[model samples]
Target chain A: MQQALQQKVQKAASAIAQECFAMRVRYLNRSLTSIYDEVFRPLSITASQVNMLVAIITQQTLSPSELGGILNIEKSTLSRNLDRMRKAGWVEIDSSQPGRSHTVQASEKGQALLLNILPLWQKAQETTCTLLGSERSKAIREVADHARSEIMKT
Target chain B: MQQALQQKVQKAASAIAQECFAMRVRYLNRSLTSIYDEVFRPLSITASQVNMLVAIITQQTLSPSELGGILNIEKSTLSRNLDRMRKAGWVEIDSSQPGRSHTVQASEKGQALLLNILPLWQKAQETTCTLLGSERSKAIREVADHARSEIMKT
Candidate 1:
């Protein structure tokens, strides 16, 4: 009976190691983030910050909550990043024109910074695609989109 | 000329929004971690903790750097988590052993906790696989493996 229980425990540990989606995803996240962070380090911004700037620029104007939703960032994290970006002259928040929300948009400095970083960002993207291989990259995007839709349904 | 520059900036922002791998992976990471964390919450452990326990159990003993490399966790993050697990009585570290590194393994209590949490962890895995669909789940694993290999080669 003790041996059977040990076997069961071993089986469970092996299964968990092999099949845990969160663990695998987190590993990928750490690995990919490390790669991208190294790529963008010379540009003085992290990968997520670049995404935030892109989202802000793409939208032109978004309330904090809307930005949070778009970026899928936590409210507190979004607020903190917005504060940092505001301080960095990369974003402007118009709280006075708000009804319980503030409008966020890229400042002229932010836009200029984006322009400056565009080449490096492109290089980073190109490096990622090349490294992951075009086919795998496409598969990742497809899976990501499908997973997002399915998760949202639940 | 000004209009052309604005168009270029917009194009850059649009490109980033469309093709940023780091952002997509982070979204998936956050979503998947949230799901697994919620599933594991009642067990008084996070999904990452389960992974740590599994790694410790499977290896019997590993140096902190070895464990971090296996899990792809950062050095500081791994150190902190190991400290927490030690405090929780889930892991035993033998610093008395020779060399600069300590050996870590799951304690009896930790092994028991793993047995206790196995069913819930299986449920989380099943739910994720079902939600992602088998094909996409498989794709995620394949892509994750390929990316890991590529990143490690650098």
Candidate 2:
């Protein structure tokens, strides 16, 4: 009887510790993002925005729907993010297509700015990868990717 | 020479793919958060704020510094998140001493509203866990925890 009770208690404690750790992960991501954003701030881009800009630049031209589809970002969030970038003169939004949203492409200035920021971004990425190690960092990215895919499909 | 060049190109491709996957993960998290925020919009709470509220409800009278520490959020980010929560009347601001900010507890209305919303939040959690499976879901959380600890030390 005592052994069974102890087993139950152990299970409860394990579950509690697990949940506690998960919350820590959220903060860790936020903190790391803070660091990247600080470094990228001089470039006049947010870490999230830099990711989006790099995507758009890679494609050269993409409709909002297409961009959202590729990035797994919501139509709304991408729209707002793109709007900010546009207003900042970093992207050109072509909204002339009837019954369809605008297609977005980075401006020449935007591309130049992105080129300047890429090396800095790489430095930030290297710091994180070095800290986390290649295997563990890749594993965390894989798990986060899988978990994110699961959530979006919901 | 040709074989070595091929291997170098393959390594570059793999590196790009890893960055792509990480960006996708970040985008999905942003989108999933938008959905959760929409669900709790009437309450004027963002998903992260809801998470903070849940943390506070679980632990009474946590200061902003202490709460920031627990959340793994930067002190500045926590301050900003707390500002909005305070404006929404979901959290109270106090001070233990000069120039120190203490976010003590939720308002009565905030407390009552959280009780009502808890079920909806739990439903989301249950559905996600069900979709991901217990083992994979647990692993995701564990990896997230590991990531958080890694960031904390860095």
Candidate 3:
């Protein structure tokens, strides 16, 4: 019976490994993330952090909740990232608004980092585009847009 | 001068937000991971863990480095995950092989969990396909394949 179960599991696992969409998505994610992360390593910032910095700077000032929503990050994860960015002096609490709610704005240092990041980001982008090809790149954008719209509906 | 620099950063940030492939891939990854994660929450496992488990079980016994290569995971990250799985009794260290090389295999409990995860995984897959649409799902597969091929080349 034990041998039979192992065989069953082996068969099922093979199928899952070959066909699971989430698995493929995750593998692709790790691959792409590594590519961008490696490129951004010299800047001492991750691709995810760069995304957050861009979002935070673009808005000028927004509450953590708003930033989380924009980034589709969970509250706890958002808080953690915010804390790290704050420690890095990339973001500051906006105290101008009087209330219990706190907001964040990119620090001057963060803005400078963003400017410096542009060229490196472009290099990463070019590498990714060349790897995935133009067709796949377009497809990724469409799928991402579809996922974003679905999030909005919820 | 500061104002001009800020304007330049803002403009650059805006472009990055809309055009960056890495950002879009990350967003889609987060969205899809959340979907699978929520579906598997009751199982007390994550989509990522499920993928790892499947890979481990299929391979029967492999060194940590081999598993990391298969999953494209960093050594530290892979070790941390293996520790968690070991503590949870989902996998076991195989000491039968001699030499300094250590190998890992899914325990009976892990095999059982994989069986239980199948139906819930199917549900998550269906939801993802519906959200992404048929065309986009195909696109995702193609892009993921392309990424995998690139990794193999490297």
Report per-prediction Cα RMSD to one decimal.
2.1, 6.9, 2.0
Residue-pair clash count for candidate 1: 0
Q: Estimate each model's TM-score.
A: 0.93, 0.72, 0.92
Q: Write the per-residue lDDT of candidate 1 for residues A1-154, one digit (tens) a residue.
A: 2777767777778878777788888887887787778877986888788889999999989999988777667899999998988998889999896477899999888888888778887777787788789998887788777776765564
The numbered model that scores best in lDDT is 3
lDDT of 3 at B64: 87
- Point out where model 3 deviates above 4 Å: A2-4, A95-99, B1-3, B96-99
Pairs that clash in candidate 2: none
lDDT for position B112 in model 3: 92
lDDT of 2 at B31: 41
In candidate 2, what are the lDDT values of residues B1-154, reduced to their tens digit?
2566434433433444357334534643554455566666776666687778766766657887878766677688788888888888887877657776655786665666665565555555565566546765565565566665665574
Determine the TM-score of chain B of model 2.
Answer: 0.75
Task: Pick the winner on TM-score between candidates 1 and 3.
Answer: 1
Candidate 1 chain A least-lDDT 10 residues: A145-154
| Model 3: chain A TM-score against the true structure | 0.89
Cα deviation at B77, candidate 3, in Å, is: 1.4
